[model samples]
Target: MSLECVHMPISPKNLLVVSHRYRSFQKDPIDLVSPYFDNVYVLVRFNKFADVSKYVHIPALQPFISSSKIDYTNKPLNLEVYKTSMFNLPLDSQYKKLGKLHLSVVEKIIGENNLNFDLIHSHFIWSAGYVGAKLKEKYNVPFIVTAHGYDVYDLPFKDDEWRSKIEYVLNSADAIITVSNSNRECIKKLDVKTPVTVIPNGYRQDLFYPSDTFKCRKSLDLPIDKKIILSVGNLEELKGHKYLIEAMDYLLRIRKDTICFIIGEGKLESRLNKQIKLAGLEKNVKLVGGKPHNEIPLWMNACDVFVLPSLKESFGVVQVEAMACGKPVVATRNGGSEEIIVSKDYGLICDPARPKELAENISLSLDKSWDSKKIDSYVSQFSLSVICNRILDIYDSVLSN
Candidate 1:
């Protein structure tokens, strides 16, 4: 599916982006779109606990906590980032109040730096979207929010109060952007009047293109003879790492020539490790903590197939990255994976959380002959250039209105 390139004329204006994690998928669009604007100001919300983590000695908690400081030495010249700390408690009732707290933190930063912007785009509806909504009221600027995963599908349906809060944020926005049709339907459940656009997450073309499989495997010190099955996601319950391990148990019964590498770190690390030991998959399935963002492309190239066993997803950007590397994907029928792996050409999809079904699909994918060039060609539509053009068109429309 080729995307039509919409080339809008660039105007001199500043853009303020409010994102919880500015370095992840949120950063992809900004990297491409920032050149068109005068300056792109990013406000990254950091947990106040990270400051305390610096003094405390907790190895288990360190993976979840990030440094409050952002090094901009290698960042884009037009991009300006502000890492601000906020008090966030992991309680269901405290969700709405966190919005006001976020607004207060943002207000302090804006006042101290005298930052100015013509528009605001926030990732995730809660807290960030709330801040955007409140700021839109204050400055009368156009505000757009991207509802990704939990913020769209889970939070709004939590309770009556959460439903009302989410509705307020959606209706308050000039426009809403979601990652998938499934998420768009979730927004429709609220029945907000605001226009919602679906812009699928994209991968960096320069970083994720095809490479030499032999060289990649050699560099990563992975076995060249084994059929590699790689899955990269945080080791959380919703990510379905446990199901993948279970599938491996079934997979090895038929074929022992495969190795599964799960790359990530989370609170569930110890529990998953214990599961691997009990299942006797310590040799077949290896939990290779987490790799750097840039190093992930090498892993993708080294693997024979990429698996995304997520139980729920808004859009699996990792699947697109793997496809860009000309590698086939075997993902679950999670909302986003089905849309990405639309046909049998790119990859196969199995029922979520089913170990036997997942194992069958993995074995089939490993034995099948896949055309790498076709898979690579199919993923071009979700490249950074195409996705950013669509987003910029939205920006132009909102500003012109």
Candidate 2:
């Protein structure tokens, strides 16, 4: 039998996209969605350099696929797609001025190229969504906004002023997309009724998956004999790393050989370091700081278990990434983890801030005999291609109406 490929109805049109992570193109959804559009213009926030890595290593960099000649030597790597261009905000600027900046940019693009975009898509509900709503009103184009992690669980509920702004943005959009079921509920709480769809952020399998265990351990200079337990997140209060570190007391109480590595850097670094020092876990638990995004899979492969102890998570995309790496996870009962860790075979779940429960689950996960292949198979639906197709379906549905 011959196989034929069927795709969603494709219309070649210009797409004006807004995102906060355009500089880090590897995880940007626009990097995946841009290929399907004739042109995609990305407006990104300009900030201090967080990483020293060269732009050439960006896995999503597609210079040849772009329509503009952008100088990559610049701090912010800009690009074009049939007509896409990424603009970084001027220093000493704020997102509150995004509407003004977007108006100026759109005026120039429409006048110079005589272009009219079919729709606008924004990532995150703050600056990007705010600008998308403005463009929708100014140009009368359909708009879509996706809320990820903190944007869903923190911003809207943080203050009444923020709630009002976010509510208006969601109410104004033609369609709303959230990364987790937990976020959909948060949107509903705003009392705005625009259709909300759950589309999780997908992980690239090429970047995150099971690899040669020995080489992975050797590359990271991690010992081969220890039972490694890993947690990858910023050392923030919301991440609940303090509790994970507390749980380690119980872990070490039983198994002296077990080690924990907490990755990512944040303001809470000093506090977490103090916690480790006070607990006398300096050797048992190490703060590896932030590693390159591509190196995360090596840690997952080397570690026996991956744990995310966030008190409240929107989607916990990293947990799915852990699952794809063929390692079992011990995550909290955050909305996202509850859906991902549906069965005990994948791993175990406990309350977010409970050290006793977390330690128990971690112990149980360590003792469990997990089938790596089965663990990897469970996350097949969250692959980048599959998630993008579902997003495209949403795009088609919105445009057809």
- Report the lDDT tens digits of candidate 1 across residue range 1-401: 23234476579999999988766477767867887889889998887764565687443454546541343424779888887687766667666689988999999999999999999999999989999999999999999999999998998898888888889999999999999999999998996999999999988887899999999999999999999999998878899999999999999999999999999876688899999999998999999987777799999999999999999989999989999999999999889998889899999999999999999999999999999999999999999788889899999999999
What is the TM-score of each predicted model, taking all chains together?
0.95, 0.83
Instruction: Go through the candidates in order and give each one's C-alpha lDDT.
Output: 0.88, 0.74
lDDT of 2 by residue, 1-401 (tens): 11111345458777777665543222344556665677766655333222212343321222122211122222222235222233433332444455455556545665676666888888887767887898888888889998876776777786776777788888998899888888888777887889998988787766777888889999999999988999987667788999999999878888787999998766677788899999999998898876666678899999999999998877787888889999999999877889889998899999889998898888888888999999999897887767777888888887777
- Measured by TM-score, the strongest candidate is 1
RMSD (Å) per prediction: 2.5, 6.3
For residue 190, give model 1's deviation from the true position in Å.
Answer: 0.5
Pairs of residues clashing in candidate 1: none
